[model samples]
Every structure is written in C-alpha cells, then in structure tokens.
Target: MRIKVWITSTVIATIGVAAWAHTGATGVVLERMQGMSAMGESIKTLTPMMRGQVPYDADLVRREADAMVGHSGEQMARLFPEGSGGGVSKALPSVWEDSEQFAALAEDLKTAAEGLKLSAGNGLATAQSNDSGSMMGGTTGGMMGGGASSMMGGGMMESNQVMTGEMFANMPADAAFTMVAQTCSACHQKFRKEDE
Candidate 1:
C-alpha cells in the first residue's frame, strides 16, 4: 500500500509540473503570434506612407505608431522565452543574458514610434514647414531618424503626394521593399535565431 501511494504521488507531481510548463509555453506562443500580427500591421501602414498616396493623417499615424510601440514593449520579450518552439523566431539565448540591451532596443523603437505619432499628430503643415522632413521622410532626422535612410530619400512629402512613386518613378521597384527587409534584419540580429 505504501509503495503504491508513493508512486501515485510522484506521478501527480510530475503531471502538475508538466501542465505548468505547457501553460507557460502556450503564453509564449500567443505572444509571438501577437507580435507577428502587429509587425504585419505596421508594414501595411507603411505602404501608403511609402507611396505618399495620402496626406499625413496624424491620427492614423499615431494609431499605427501606438500599435508598433505597444508590441515592442509588451510582446517582444514574451516571444523569446526559453524552451519555446523556435518556429520562425531568430531570437538568441543572449537575449536573456543581455536583457537590458534588448529591452533598450525595444525602448528605442517605442520612442521612435511615439515621436512619429506626435509629429504626425501635428499635421503636414508642421512637417513640411520644418526644414527637415517629418516622420514620413524616412530621413535619419525624421521619426525613424534615418536608420533606414537609404530606403527613402530624406524628404518629407505631403500625405497625398505618393513620394516614392512620384519622386523615384523610374527606379526599380525594390527600393520600397528594403524598408521591410531592414526591419527584419534589425530584429533578427538581436532576437532571432542566428544562422548556423
């Protein structure tokens, strides 16, 4: 009777631990999914911005910026927890050890997004009025402040202007694509799986 009771107790404890681990893993997966979705939305928002098809809508820009900033703050960390199925994640173990730096990058992204929202909120007049283009210019001094300056010439255009299509009409189509690529590279370098 004693032997059977001890075995049963051990089995129950093991199951409980497994269940707890599974729950944590599930949370991590969900967080990753949410981050991916937010990133996708941010890209979508950039489409019109890149084209300069519409005048800068401060409210719309702010909302998109808010989403991106929120994702950086809330979801980036959760996606890289230890033991989560890596799937497409490029996150490295160094993220845990160098959490402060990782978080700082995330914070920088958040700050950039916030600045974008504020700049966009003030309207196109403010953006164009300033010698430096507003957030839409893709300039280093702009909201993203030129991190991916090569992606777009550092010039602020009206929201309705469709800057890339209008200004670089003759260029190969790949210019706009680099914006997304740069973002992926930045994130993958720090958080994602390093190529073996």
Candidate 2:
C-alpha cells in the first residue's frame, strides 16, 4: 500500500508539471498570434493611404498607431519566458541574456510609432511642411504594388502633396503599416525561426 501511494503521488506531480508547461507554451503562442493579427490589421488600414486611394485621416491614423505601439510593447515583455535564464526564446537566448538592449529597441519602436501618430494628428499641412521625412519612412504602400500613383488608379499625388479630403474622404484608412513592419522585422530577426 505504501508503494502504491507513493507511485500515485509521483504520477500526479508529473501530470501537474506537464499541464503547467503546456499552459506556458500556449501563452507564448497566443502572444505571437495576437501580435501578428494586430500587424495585419494595421497594414489593411494603411493600404488606402499608401495607394493614395483615400486621403489620410488624423483620427484614424492616431487610433491605429496607438494600438500598434501599445501592442508592440506589451508583446515584447510577454515574449520572454518566466525563467529560462532570461533569453531562452526561440529567438536564441541572446535576447533574454541581454534583455536591456532588447527592451531599448522595443522602446525605440514605440517612440517612433508615437511620433508618427502625432504627426498624423496634425493633418496634411504638417505632413507637407515638415521635410524631415517620415517618422517611419520607406514607402508604406509599396508592398501592395507600384508607386502610390499606380495603386490609386492615377489619383496618387506627389510624395509632398498636401493631403486633402478630395483625395481620401471616400476611403477612411489608417496609417500604421510602417510602424508595425518595423516591429515585425525586429522580432523575426531576433526571435522567430529563421527557416520559417
């Protein structure tokens, strides 16, 4: 009877540990999924703006940018496992081992995204007046196709054009693609499976 009881307890303990591990893995997977979904949505929102299919809306841009920045920060922290010695992420232990550096990059992305949102809120005049270049520049809509003009069916304006209602009123779109892209690139380079 003593032996049987001991065996039973051992089995139970093993099961509990297995359950806990599964739960942790699920949390990690879920975080990745949510982060990817948010980025996809941001791209969709920015499509129209990049293509010049619709004029930029300050409110929509700000809302989407805020979401992207917030999610990026939250996801970064969640990514590191509880005590895998800090950086046991599929991202190669280097990330967790040097957490401070990883965190700084994440913060950089958040700040740049926030700046983009602020610029968007100020409207077209702000976009044109400031020749400092985009807070997250590199041709936002090019992922979809040719330059903005081709994508918008010839409605595309010069990069410096003062965005107007006539250009984007019909289509309400957000401008958070570049920001999201940066986060994705950073994560993929540091953590995700390169072969994937």
Candidate 3:
C-alpha cells in the first residue's frame, strides 16, 4: 500500500512535468531539470517491478539503476553553481547556503544506485520473495516529460521530477532502493522550494 501511494504520487508529479517545459530555462538549469526528469522516469520503471505488478527483470533493473547513477553525485552537484537560485527556480536558499549537506545527499544517491545495481545483479529482487502484490493490469500513459515550466536560472529540480531506508531490511534490492529514495527525499525537504 505504501509503495502504491509513492508510485501514484511520483507518476502524478511526472505527468505534470510533461506539459510544463523549460521556457526561459536554458543551459545547466534546463539540463538539470531534464536530468531529474530522466531519473524520475527510471524510478517509475522500477516501481512496478518493486510492486510485483510486473515481472522481475535483472537486466532492466540494472539499467534503470545505472541511469539514476549517471545523474547523481558529482554530476548532479555540478548543475548548481553560486548565484543560480531565485527566479523560476524551485530551489531554496539552503542549497547554496548549506552546500556540504546537499552534496552529501547527492553522493548518497549515487551510492544507493550503485548498491541497487549490485543487489539486482546478485539476484535480490522483490519478486524473489513474493512481497509484491498481483500483477497489475494495463499501463499508465501520457508521461511526456517536462519540469516546472519557464525557469530563468540554474537550480535543482523536484525530487519526484527525479524520485527511504533501513526499515527495509527484508530484501537487498528493497534496501538499496529505499536508501536511494531517502537521499532524494532528504535533499528535497531541505533544498527544494515548496510549491507555493
């Protein structure tokens, strides 16, 4: 049930991005938004499998994890430079105000993605233990991909425009995935602006 809610929320958020484009947003601002959007799509692909709504495929899981790993860590941190906040940006002042913690969170995400890849390759999937529900029918549509329309400066994107922890010791994949997501949540809660 919890995974269901998370998946629903992520999907809803990503769907909104589809119609919203980077109008004035260009350069690295747009680049990071697109990176976040891509990461979100990768997480979306894994959720169904994590939910057991779809069959477990190690190859697919590893691929998505790799995609996430690509956008995170130093890669993610480089997108934000000094004086890149405000305007259409959704980033809060703390990103620049508290750069160290933000960078830690980014590194944490990369580490988590790497852990997920390792777990998947080692045959640790939710499908292995029947923790997932029955295979869900049909497919979700219209996730064309966009982000917080018309941003003028460089900044961070929504976490859901991208994509939790040790309570998930049951499966290795689950554990790694939760850790990866927790990093995202932590970064968003502290760095990203609320949708006011």
By TM-score, the best candidate is: 3
Evaluate all candidate structures by whole-model CA lDDT and list the values in order. 0.44, 0.44, 0.60
Best-to-worst TM-score order: 3, 1, 2
lDDT tens string, model 1, 14-91? 223332333334466656655655655565655455345556555676677677667764456555666764543434
lDDT of 3: 0.60
Each candidate structure's TM-score, on Cα atoms with residue i matched to residue i, is 0.51, 0.50, 0.70
Give the residue spans of candidate 2 off by over 4 A. 1-25, 82-90, 122-180
Angstrom error of the Cα, residue 91, model 1: value is: 2.5
lDDT of 3 by residue, 28-133 (tens): 8788878877877787777767666777787897899999999999999999998887775666899898999888789877866876787674333323433443
Candidate 3 residue pairs in backbone clash:
17-146, 40-162, 164-181, 164-182
- Candidate 2 yields a Cα-based lDDT of 0.44
